[model samples]
Target chain A: MFAHPFLQNAFLAGTFVALAAGLVGWFLVLRAQVFTADVLSHVAFTGALAALAAGLDARIGLFAVTLLVALAMGALGRRARPGDVVIGGVFAWVLGLGVFFLTLYTTVRSGTGNGSAGVTVLFGSIFGLTASRAVGTAVVALVICALLLLLARPLLFASLDENVAAARGVPVRLLGFAFLLLVGGTAAESTQVVGALLILGLLAAPAGAAHRLTTRPLRGLALSAGIAVASVWIGLTASFLVPVLPPSFAILAVASLTYLGAAVGTRLRGTRPTVVER
Target chain B: MTGTFSWNLLADLREMWSLPFMLNAFRAGTIVAVPAALVGWFMVLRRQSFAGHTLAMVGFPGAAAAVWLGIGATVGYLAFGVLAALLFALLPAGRGGGDESSAVGTVQALALASGMLFVALYKGFLNGTSALLFGSFLGITSRQVVLLGVVAAVALTVLALVGRPLLFASVDGDVARAHGVPVRSLGGVFLVLLGVTAAEVGQITGALLVFALLVLPPATVQVLTTRPARGLAASVLLAVVTVWVALFAAYYSPYPLGFWLTTIAFGGFVLAYAGRAVVDRIGRLAVAP
Candidate 1:
């Protein structure tokens, strides 16, 4: 699995992205923001295309746009009623922009006589990423993981207990905004590896499966990242053998199956019923 | 600049309607908007927006499988959507709300991934995945238009019969259950209705933009009104007006119909929110310092 150059890049890229996604996903789940995490994936779709429409690197728009939108969602969600309503509003808002950007990218490409080589906004083009780009992606993912570790203590405090953490002078709102930005970053990176639409599976599944097994924050976090990285390894290996279907979908499948397996396993034990996080 | 501001709106409208496809597009849009808005209103009211969204996501796989199987894409959409809906309904009932969403989220994520897999497996897929995002709305033929009419008629009529009980159940499931409304069964029925509506709207707006059509208008309307009947009517009205205006704009402009529809719908929501905030401020001022 590691001998081929393209395969190496795929493995490395998937590893880094999954690690970051898993770490942030634990917080996303604990915070009851899986929908928000999903929303950021959609935003990343527009961000990448919006970049190409302006003749810039797709990665630049991918990160910049998602980070900004994440901040905006965090701020707006605080003021909006019925949290689901806010999420729905954001979904519509981002999708409209994605449609606009998609049209713009297609039209601009056709007009400029450029080959249709831009980012594939529908599912992503992870299989086509060059080795150098994959390395850069891994480096960014590492930086994101490091940043997450720095904030892990307070972030968990806030995620587990917002009002109590706020009363403890934890700057809960700031942490929320900051956490969303991290989610946005993870989303942008994950989009490159599995496309935007599938990022939700990568981010949510591993953490969910880990949560199913254990409730302790650190153990669950480690287990989540482990599951995520393992999913990538197995998915990449499976795609290598097949080489037909894209690896992103395979990665998502592995992650989802892990969660399902864990869900079933936990149910069988009858010790831990799935707790609804409020 | 091709579609610069025109003073003679009527002339532009006349020119647009001259084309048969444009007429078909508008006709289809008109049909799909009603039930979408009606169900959308209840979706938001019941706080099932997440489930609604998950259903929309499932439509992608539904449509993709339809194309892969050489059956019509419409069949795939309805089949996959309804299948997913049944699956969601079957998730262990009444586990804490949190567990249900997680399960729903897991199903949604898996469905989306499976959609990609199905598209990839089709080997002949050059554009099927993208179609799942934007849909092929501009090329509506007369047959599809007629199909749209049948679907819209059935969805609206069913909604009419179930609308009252559905709303009561949505507002207070426990109370409705006490009143012999079969709340659990009604929940299943509503999810199925939502599935059909998603498949219907997926034809107009594509799976990606389905959330816009199904979630935005009703959410915006709810932000403005609390009265049940009035709110329902307003949501449907908003859906109709936005679709009509968006159809007109898309025909004259160089954009896909779904884009114009989403933007116009979002614009309505934002404007309503601002109006509500302003009115609330005035009411507060009148009541106190």
Candidate 2:
């Protein structure tokens, strides 16, 4: 499988995507912002379609739109965490915009012959990546992972106790704004690997599994990233072996099953799962 | 497909209904809207939007598996929807917490992956994938409309029966439980109802966009009112109006019906939110000095 250029590209890009998603997802679950990730996934789709409709590169739209909405959501939410109401409102509107752009792209730009573009945005087209595009995706994912590492301590402080962090002058709100932007970037990137519909799986499942498996913050973070990368590798291999399986399906199925395993393990250990206090 | 809007609104509406497809679309949209808004109101109140979203997402796999099995999509929708709801009900209720959200996310992922698997396994040309995800108005058969009506009717009747106790439980679970309200069972029942509503609405707005009818209208009305009766009434009204206007607009325009439905519903929410903000500002100014 590694002999094939496409398989090589898939692994290269999928590895980095999984790393960034795992790190960012640990913080996302810690901060109770999984809903925000969900909202951004839809935003990535709408942004990509909007960009296509306006005759621009879909990546430009994907990144620009998700980032802007993340900032906007940060501004609208209290303590930089948007409530359900805000998330739900934005979610519906973004999906609506996606439909509008789909209509425009189908009717005016590419015609109905190219309906696959929309499907690609919804389900991802990772195997279709060129060598250059895969490298570009890796570079982007590395930058996200590096930035998240730099912000990890302060972000953790802020996420664990916003009031105490604010009292200690940790710039809680700024850190929150910055963290949301990172999440937005990761969400946009994950859309390429898993598609808009299932990006949350890559963002939440491994992190959640790690949380269930361990309470040590640093160990959990490492475990999360490890599980994520393993899922990607295993999923890719499974899909390569079974051509009938989609890559996204394989990846998310592995990720989710890992989480279930952790949950069941914790239950069998007969220990009450430690609940992180907000 | 290039239909122009005319000044005569009545004539245009009559012309719209003159087509059988448009008529069926209207019927289906209306049937989906009422139960969606009703269940969505309680869902928002209970802070279960994540669960509602998960149930809606499950419809994709339901539809895909149905197509794979050569069965009706509605059966798949309702079956998967209720099954997922039951699964959710089995989880320890941790409202708006990280544990609950993670669990919900995991379920959503599993369901979506299963959907992709079903789609991959199906050898036939599944051309209606777009319609199943984004929804289309062109294929609203009379049979589908009638099925939606029956589901809506059953859901609404259950909602009516459990309305009061459900509200009490949702508002204050501990107290309701102390008072012997069967809080847990009521929660389970409501979740099933929400699943059914999500499935019904999924047919009209698509599985991905079910929130257009389920969340937007209820969220908007809750922003506008605190009274339960008034909020429920306003939610139903907003949803029905949004669906009617969207259907009418979509008939004349080239865009899909789901787009118009979501856009109009979102517009109502924005208006409500802004209106509330403006009222609070004015009230503060009146009190100051």
Tens digits of lDDT, candidate 1, A96-180: 7887777787786777654333225546666677999999999999999999999999988877667788899998788788788
What is the two-chain DockQ of model 2?
Answer: 0.74
- For candidate 1, the lDDT comes to 0.81
- Listed per prediction, chain B TM-scores read 0.94, 0.97
CAPRI quality level assigned to candidate 1 from its DockQ score = medium
* Per-residue alpha-carbon lDDT of candidate 1 for residues B142-232, written as tens digits (9 for 90 to 100): 8988887897788788888888898888888889988999878778888988998998889878888888889988999999989988988
lDDT of candidate 2 over B204-272, digit per residue (tens): 788889988889999999998889999999999989999999987887778888788888998888998
Cα lDDT of candidate 2 equals: 0.89
lDDT (Cα, tens digit) per residue for candidate 2, span A11-33: 99999999999999898888888
TM-score of each: 0.94, 0.98
Off by over 4 Å in 2: A111-113, B1-4, B124-126
Give the CAPRI rating of model 2: medium
DockQ of each: 0.55, 0.74
Task: Report lDDT (CA) for all predictions.
Answer: 0.81, 0.89
Which ranges of candidate 1 are over 4 A from the true structure?
A: A79-82, A111-119, A274-277, B1-11, B95-98
